[model samples]
Target: MYKLLVIEDDVMMSDMLSMYMSGEGYEIKQAENGEQGLKLLEQFVPDVVLLDLMLPDWDGTELCIRMRQHSTVPIMIVSMKSEVSERVQALRAGADDYLCKPFSMHELSARVEALIRRARLMQPNAAGGQQEEAGQASEKEIKLDSERRLLLVRGTFVETTFSEFEIMKLFLTHPGKVFSREDLINAIRGFDSFVTDRAIDVHIVNLRRKVEKNPKEPHYIRTVWGVGYKYVTEVEATR
Candidate 1:
């Protein structure tokens, strides 16, 4: 069974989530504060984390960053803070998904399942067979190993978040195709996620910092003025 750690200060909300998700077959562990949440994170080592921003001891964004330092486990922020800035902050701090509070249990369940599914897909051994060769075209500067969910830029492996890797996979596979922010949002987080254009922009900026030789004047992923962004084809990258 998949494990889940819920870090929420609200007693009622915590219990409700625990009960509902327990029925969904997740082994549930609850923490009433951020300190306890961090402690449980180490001990429980859950498949997914359901975190709240308003913890008594620590800001959720800070906690998210701390957790990221230690583990790549998926974190879904479940909070009353619905502001785009708040969501951006959480995502920038390393959250894989964000769901505002007062949410439907069904939708929350779906998001949780998606996170776990994506996490599983990222595992090198999740496919349980001989690994396939890394996928690449004639472009010798960038390589994508989908079986291992790894990105190698110029022969060096660059660390990437799940969303960043997914975006790169899409861009590399369909070079020169423009993808709107909305399209990227759906591709990474699915249709049920609470994502904004700013979130996608933040992801793009972070990605550019990692893969681009000069983020200020990106050569691989270029902006399309008002529409969106696209990956440069081999010809464009060479030039």
Candidate 2:
């Protein structure tokens, strides 16, 4: 049975979710404020956390970051705010996914299952089994210092956000593999997250500006023109 912790102040919504999720065989725990949520976390470690942004005690972003300080459990933000910037901020703050207000319960359940599955697959990465050697450049010759949240292009440090860093890490790790927008979203955020195309484009643009010598004329991240984007790898001609 998957344990779900819901940190929402809305009494009606919490009651509704508790009844529905309990019927689905998930152990449901509810907290009306961030302080209570943090307290409950000590006693009941949940498989996933359903968080609301408008907590009476603490702002949701701060709570999300605080949760990340101790746990990697997936956090799905259920908020009424649907702006791209708001979504970006929550994701960057360490929430695994975001769902806007007035969402379908079916979609919410699907997202919960997807997040748990992805988190299971990501355990290897979290345990240091899948990370590339820190401070070492791959064959493509780019170094990513995930510990420092830093990206190095040609041995020079460049500024990158959580979103940009994750996307760049995916591209660099896969080398020439093409990643569609949906694929990137699923990898960085969760499956079917509330991220918009504009958000992805913004991250791509920001990455280009930092990594490319000239963002307009890029040599590293290339657009597939109608498909998606891929990291360009230099091929040496065999003499």
Candidate 3:
């Protein structure tokens, strides 16, 4: 069975989400604040994380940044703040998917199921026996080809670590698609790889510093106010 972590401050909200997800046959863990959520991540390697943007100790976006520094667990934002800016910011912080509050149970279940399904599909090749062909390709030096690889400022022969390359590949492949820390974790980590979610954010920061012209106000990797990061492309490519 897949295990899930839910980070929410509201006792009732967290309980309801936990119970419903539990009924779905998933092992559910709950945290009242970002601090506790980080601790849970260290102790329990959940398959997916249901993250809330608003937390007592830390904002959800900040938590996402911290978590991305360590892990790639898929994160789905379950929050009440529906502002476009908020959603864009969450995505920029590393959220995989955004879901507004006052949502339906069925919708929640579907979202969780989708996250699990995607996570399974993203497993490392050869049943986790080896790093797999994709990893090897990412590790091996290859020539820079913007059109072929969907790469932007970073070149194919990027002088960076494998973790940074993995994050870049995701953006290149799906330009303009927002990815939170949780999404980054789920998409990159191997099926059996043990890493914290915050670790993912560290990689993102490093990656930006390496590739972006200005990491602070980046042009290639622009943060969505209420969502996550999106790799903006040139107009010629849009056609």
Candidate 4:
């Protein structure tokens, strides 16, 4: 059974989520504040976390940042704040998805299901097999270890978020293919996620910072003027 950790201060809201998500067959754990939530996060190790932005003990974004330092579990921000800036902040803080309050239980369930599905897909190879490596082997060695969900640049592991990893995986698999912002958003978050096009730009920028020696003049992920971005193929990287 997939486990879910819900960190919500609202008593009624927490109860509602527990009841509804339980009915959906997810093993549920609740935390009324940030500190308690962090404790439960380590002990329970849930597959997905449903977090609220307004916590009496801690700011949701800060908590999200802290969580990212220790775990890669998918986080979905369920908050009353509907502003684009607020959503972007949470995403930049390491949230994988965002859902506004007053949401339907059905939609919440669907998003949770999607999160679990993606998590499973990204797990290390089940048979203890060799880690798959894909990338150019020229002066700059870029390697993708799917089993570890890690991106290695010049033999160094570059930390990446779930979305960042997915984007890189896609780029490495199909180098030289131009993917629009919408395409990337859909590919990583799926059509159900509440994400804006600008969010993709933020992800790309963050990714470049980690993968490129100098983000200003990116060599691997090139921006296609007027369209979107693409991973430079071996031949393209040479020029």
Error of 3 at 204 (Å): 22
lDDT for model 1? 0.83
lDDT digits (tens) for residues 133-229 of candidate 3: 2454432222223222223343434454434655676665555678876777766553214445568767777877866666887656666665556
lDDT of each: 0.83, 0.79, 0.70, 0.83
* Candidate 3 lDDT (Cα, 0 to 1): 0.70
Model 2: CA > 4 A from native: 82-85, 125-163, 172-176, 185-205, 212-227, 231-239
Error of 4 at 71 (Å): 0.2
Worst 10 residues of 4 by lDDT: 125-134
Q: Model 3 — TM-score against the truth?
A: 0.59
Residue lDDT tens for model 2, 1-239: 99999999999998887788888889999999999999877789999999999999999999998988777788999999988888878877878789999999888898888889866755655445234444223433555765455787777887677678778877766667788888777676652355677788788888888877789987788888888889874331111
Q: Say which prediction, candidate 3 or candidate 4, comes out ahead on TM-score.
A: 4
Error of 1 at 187 (Å): 2.4
Give the per-residue lDDT digits (tens) of candidate 4, residues 1-239: 88999999999999999999999898999999999999999999999999999999999999999998888898999999988789878876778888998999999999888888766754543221122322324624676765456788888988777688789877776667899998898777632265678888998999889887789999889999889999885457768
Q: C-alpha displacement of 174 in model 1, angstroms?
A: 12
Total clashing residue pairs per candidate? 0, 0, 47, 0
